[model samples]
Target: MVFEDLGIMPAILEALKGEGYINPTPIQEKAIPILIKGKDLQGCAQTGTGKTAAFAIPILQRLSQNPLQKQGPKPIRTLILTPTRELAIQIGESFASYGKNVNINHTVIFGGVSQGAQVDALRRGVDIVIATPGRLIDLNNQGLVALNKIEIFVLDEADRMLDMGFVNDVKKIIKLIPKHRQSIFFSATMPDSITQLASSILTQPQYVEVTPVSSTAETIAQELYFVDMVNKRDLLLHILKDKELKSILVFTRTKHGADKVVKLLERESIKAAAIHGNKSQNARQKALNDFKDKKLRVLVATDIAARGIDIDELELVINYEIPNIPETYVHRIGRTGRAGQIGKAISFCDSDERIYMRDILKLTKINIPVANEHPFLPAEGNTDLSTAVKPKAKAPLPRENRPRNHAYGSTSKGGNGQRKRENSF
Candidate 1:
């Protein structure tokens, strides 16, 4: 159904149209009505499902209808708490886009960057505050943010927050806010812990779920490779020989692993970048922007970035390192194959990682076609990693070794019009 049918006002409808948003996503169709009616909502949906607009639009409408009429600093009426700074910034962008006609002021607060700008924004007074758990609590403790007047509270990506060990902070925030506030809770998965958290905050909440994390989209073709750990990098380089695989998203399990992938690809003259927890905020954002603009063809990232990356036409995702968590595999591949676009996910499973792959397949309930003839295929017959039958894996042509200490201060591109990794975040 269209946004018009979901009770959105003309001004907000015009704003949505400006963003080229046409039909409502399923979550928007189901949750928007309930939220607009001032009801608590529990939404269990994964990223790329357009869940942000489901609540953003209605809140914009509600705030516009009853504009705050105070002359002093504007009390924050809405608070959106997300797990990562990227997600919080993206949510802020959504609010700015959807609330263009609503005349509301909002600021995003997160760590890793200096708090000078954030503190200034908070002191200047904002109608809405979208923040991460740590930065929000820090500001609250410093007496810069008072949430007692929050009317609409949003606990987004609840599961991720808890996974990041933000449960106590979340509880503290909840206790500070008025209990009568309208709460909107959403998680990609509904584990028992997430359910308990939702129950604590939501009052008779309407439930709507879509795109559960365990299921992969049918449009994505999953390919598996049996390469040993040392040869996994070689398998990645071998796969990159295909010129058709443009704009690839590579996932690694550790921050150092992501950096290593970027270094290997850069030495091959293959443009790449890495984003993880340790990278400076500017570096991570710049790398992500470069990838999105198609200046960079490949982006290597950790699971912290698994969610909240909403790139259009992203079609290839390579898992250089499979995650132990089965659900993360879903989130990783879900980055591609979005908007019904045909996507491909290539996973390299070493003998040690076969158990992880097995759990992923079992969770998704789909058989991934394995590639047995790859150059890096373990020399031994392809067998379950649990079994002690393995041979050597192959690699591509040799590359001279080079030392890496620091080089995140260049933004120049060369070699086949590919954007080189000037700064490996």
Candidate 2:
């Protein structure tokens, strides 16, 4: 259905047309109506599902329809809490684009940078505030921000927040807001932790789900390559020789791994960049812009840094390192095949990571055809899919034993994992 049928205002409809968005995505079609009614909502959809517009459009309409009397500067009427600075910034951009003609104003604040400018923006006043949990709390504690004026509270990327260990901070922010406000919780997957968190925050919320985690986009062509862990880099370099696989996104599991991949690619005289927790805010933004503009041939990223990445006609995604969680595999591949474009997702699996491949196959419930024509294929390759050996069952690693590449949270088992937020600006 078209966006007009979803009750979006004329201003937003015009803005969307300028942005070349005529039809509504499935998530947008279902979630916008409930949210426009000022009802609490719980949405489960994967990345690249246009969920940002689903909420941002209605928010702009509501705030514009009910204009409040201004005393000095407008207090923040809506608060949107997200896990990463990238996603927070993207949401703020969405608000700006959709509300350009409206009277509402919004700003985004995150950690990893000096707060002087953010504080100055807060002082100037805004109607909507998009922020990461840590920086928001820091400003709130310093008496620079106030959430008591919030009429609508949004917790975007709830599952990612749990992955990043922002539950306590989220709970703290929830307590500060007025309890009578409307709430919206959106997550890619409803893990038990996210479900419980949604239950505590939402009051009789309406549920909307689209494109379950187990499914992948039909436009994507999936393939797998088996190689030794030591030769994965060589395999990647070899694959790039085609020159047709332009603008590829390579995923690594850790920050160090991402950096290592970048260095290796550079040594071969390939123009590439890395985005992760270790880079400065300016550096990360520059790298992302370069990749999007086709200045760089490759962009190496970790799972967290890649959450809010949206690029058009980005047809190639290479999994340099497979993720441990099966659901993560779906998220990684979903980066491509976006906006009605056909895409390709190629995965590199080493001997030790075969178990991960097995789990991914089980989760997607489809067998990925193996590409055996590559030059870097392992000597004992092409094993029987049904008889692949699983990793030996063992106790989880201790906190100190697990690698500390992520910005926040530990390698702990319980979802109560705690870590610092806003490591990357």
Candidate 3:
């Protein structure tokens, strides 16, 4: 449906036009109306669903339509809590773009950088504060920010917050805010934890689910590549030989893996960059900007670091390391095939990660066609899928015995499990 039908104001509509957004996605179509009514909303959707605009647009309209009495400085009227710095910054940018003509100002609060400027912005006053829990709490403790005046409270990427061990911090922030505020909760998936969190935060919220939690987009063609763990770099290089993949997002399980992949690509003179928790904020932003500008052929990132990455017409996503969590596979490929556009997801799987592939296949309930057209077959040169899962000469290492690389929330073994909270930042 067109945004005008969704109750968007004329000025915001004009702003959207300048941004090239005329129609709303399904999530936006459903969630925007309910949110514009000022009702508590619980949205279950994934990345690429345009969920940001679903809430951002309504928020700008509401705040603008109901102008509050003039005060000395703007108190925080809205609090949007997200998990990562990247997602928080992206949300802030969305607010700026959509609320340009409106009388609202937002300051993004994140870690990995000094808070001097963030504090300055807060002191100057803002109508909204889009923040990560840790930094917000830090500023709140120092009396630099306050949320008691919040009229709208939004918890974006709730599942990711819990996964990143920010649940306690989120609960703390909720306690600090007005309990009577209109709560907006959005999560890619609704596990029991997310369900309970929503129940506690939202009061009689209207449920708007645009997509099933377990499924991938039908517009995406899924392809699987079975290769040896040692030959993964070679397989990736071979795939890059296809110049048609003008821009590719490669997901690695760890920061070290991401760096290693970027190094391999750079050595071959293929422009590439890696983004993860370890990289500085400026470096990460530069890499992301480069990738968005198509200046980098490959942008390798870990799962958490890739949050809130919305690239227009991005058609390809590569899984350099298969994730143990099947649900994660859904989020990864969701980066492509955005807004009903056709896209492709190519996954590289080794014998060690066959279990992950099976889990993903079972969760998605679709047999991903093995792309055997590539020349990365084994010594036997067979294209059989089961051959990769066949018996091996040496037994696999136990989870504890394996060397682990901490990417974003690296657990005892590896992968995007839970890590410590962002307390210091």
Candidate 4:
């Protein structure tokens, strides 16, 4: 349904229209109404389902209707706690975009950068504060932020926060907020710990769930390659050669793994970048922006860093390394096939990672089609499933001793742009 039917204010509706937002996503359609009614909500939705707008729009509308008159330089009326700086910034951007017509001011605060600018923003006063837990607690400890005034509290990516070991910090923040205020909670998946945490803070919250993390989207074509660990990189380069895999998001299990993937792709004269916790905030943001703008064709990222990446036309997600957590696999591939668009999730599984692959299969209850016709196919074992794909001629890999100076160019004629249709069963 259209966003207008959700009772969004004309000002916020105009801003949404300016952003070209037409229909409300499922999460938005369900959660917006409950949130606008001044009720606590628990939303279980995966990344790229427009979770930002579901909460941001209603918060902005609520604040606008009852403008804070206790103004001594606007105390924060809404506080959003996310797990990462990148996500905090993106949520802050969403508030700015959706609240432009509402005349609400908001700022994002995170660690890894000097608190000078964030402190300045706080001193100047803001209606909303979007922040990461660590920096938010640190600043509050230093008496820099006054959160007692918060009326609307949002704990976003709750599972990620707990996975990142921010449970204690979240608890501390919850204690600071007024007990009677409206609280909104979101998580990709909810474990018992998350359930307990929600019960402690929320008062009979309305639950809204869509596309549970255990399930992958039916629109995404899942492809698997059984390659040796050493040859997984080659498989990636080989697949990229098809030129049909445009704007790919590659996931690695570690910060170093992400960087290594980026370096390996660069050696083949492929433009790529890596984003992880170790990278400076600016570096990570630049890499993300470059990938979104299509200046860089590939962005290798660790799972935590990839949170809140909302790219609509992202067509491909490559799992260079399988995650130990089955649900993480869902989150990784969910980056593509967003907003009802068809996408592809291609994974490379080595013999050692077979267990991880098995876990993912058990969790999703879907057998990812194995693409067995690649050159890097493991020589032995059941790693390469005997699937129905007809074996095609193998492509030659560049010699290890070859110089890395060959420049790559965009090919006018590439493989058919059609996505491979396989029974994902």
Q: Which stretches of candidate 1 lie over 4 Å from their true place?
A: 211-221, 226-234, 243-344, 348-359, 370-425
Which structure is stronger by lDDT: 2 or 3? 2
User: Candidate 3 on 1-425: residue-level lDDT in tens?
Assistant: 78889878998898677555777889898999899999999999876577888888888889889878986887889899988765665576567556666677778787656678788788888888888888889999999888889999999989988977899999999999998888999998899989999999999999999754588999999999988788889999999999888989999976678999999999999999998766755687799899989899889988766755688788699999887657779988999998989999999987777767887887899989997777776555544444346223432311211333331111011112222111010
TM-score of 2: 0.66
Clash-forming residue pairs, model 4: none
Residue 396 alpha-carbon offset, candidate 3, angstroms: 22
lDDT (tens digit, per residue) of candidate 1 on 1-425: 78899899998898677545778888899999999998999999765577888888888888778887769887889999988765665576567657766677688777766677777777777778888888788889899888988999999989988877898989999998999989999998899999999999999999999864588999999999888787887788888999987799999866668888999999999999988655654687799899999889999997664445677899799998877668779888988888889999999887767777887888899988988777877866665644633222321111111122321211111122322121100
lDDT of candidate 2 over 162-221, digit per residue (tens) = 877889999999999999998999998898888999999999999999975688999899
Going through the candidates in order, what is the number of backbone clashes in each?
A: 0, 1, 0, 0
Off by over 4 Å in 2: 191-196, 216-221, 226-234, 243-344, 349-359, 369-425
State the weakest 10-residue window (summed lDDT) of model 3. Answer: 407-416
Q: How accurate is candidate 1 locally (lDDT)?
A: 0.78
Per-model lDDT:
0.78, 0.80, 0.79, 0.77
| Candidate 4, 1-425: lDDT as tens digits | 79889999898788677555778889999999999999999989866577888998889889889886664787988899988765665575566556666667788777766678788888888888888888888898999999998999999989988877899999999989899899999998889999988888799999999975688999899998888888988888888997876799999866667888889999998999998655654687789888888899899987666765688799899999877667789988998898889999999887667767887898899988888788887877566433313222321111112223221111111013311111000
lDDT of 4: 0.77
Candidates ranked by TM-score, best first? 1, 2, 3, 4
CA shift of 203, model 2, Å: 2.9
| Candidate maximizing TM-score | 1
RMSD of 3: 9.6
